[model samples]
Target: MAQTATRHAKLWFAGQAENWALAAYEIDELHEGMEDAGKYHPTHKQIKQAIPELIAQYVDQPLTALEQAINAKNKAEFIANYDKLTAGCNACHQATEFGFNVVQRPSFNPFANQAF
Candidate 1:
């Protein structure tokens, strides 16, 4: 989850800077992390829904849109879909009773070592 959060923030910065290559890499990383989560923890004892199911419902479509936006190099579409993806993350957290783990656009870049 922590890794996912970092990638999420980095993805935002990459896209904002119009660094399509980095954004694409981050998107792939994010997707792989989600897939690994689903594979390793199919179900949480507290959450009624399966982890994979929840991810499919909340993340997949927005992720696809994000990919398309990046492919087109469309900043406006990328930002809109990015917010949608963030909302999906929050929605998943809410579903898992982890609503406190709210995610938002990065207000500041924390990865100073890596140029976005």
Candidate 2:
């Protein structure tokens, strides 16, 4: 889950850099991550099963919008949906009693060796 969230943040960074191609690639990766999570991420499966409504509303829906914006290469809509995605993540955390682990649009690259 942390890894997926980190990748999501990186997607945001790529979008912020106006690197739409990179952002699109990362969006694909993020979607794949979610798919893998559904299959293999135990906690993800648990929460998703327990709170289908929240997951659908916050996580799935926002990610679908993000994907659409990325596919369209609409910078403005992409930015808007990125914010939605961030809120969705935090909303999930809060719903699951992990609100202290606040996810934000990262201010710096957490990857020390990678350039954004």
- Candidate 1, residues 1-116, lDDT tens digits: the string is 99999999999999999999999999999999999999999998799999999999999999999999999999999999999999999999999999998999999998989987
lDDT against the true structure, each candidate: 0.96, 0.78
Off by over 4 Å in 1: none
Candidate 2: residue 110 Cα off by (Å): 3.3
Clashes of 2: 0
Among residues 3 or more apart in sequence or in different chains, the pairs in candidate 2 whose N, CA or C atoms overlap within 3 Å are: none
Off by over 4 Å in 2: 42-54
Q: What digit string (tens of lDDT, one per residue) describes model 2 on residues 1-116?
A: 77787788789888877788888888888877766655664354335444445556678888889888877878899889988888888987888777898887787787777676
In model 1, what are the clashing residue pairs, if there are any? none
Report the lDDT of model 1 for residue 70: 94
Best by TM-score: 1
User: How many pairs of residues collide in each model?
Assistant: 0, 0
lDDT of 1 at 68: 97
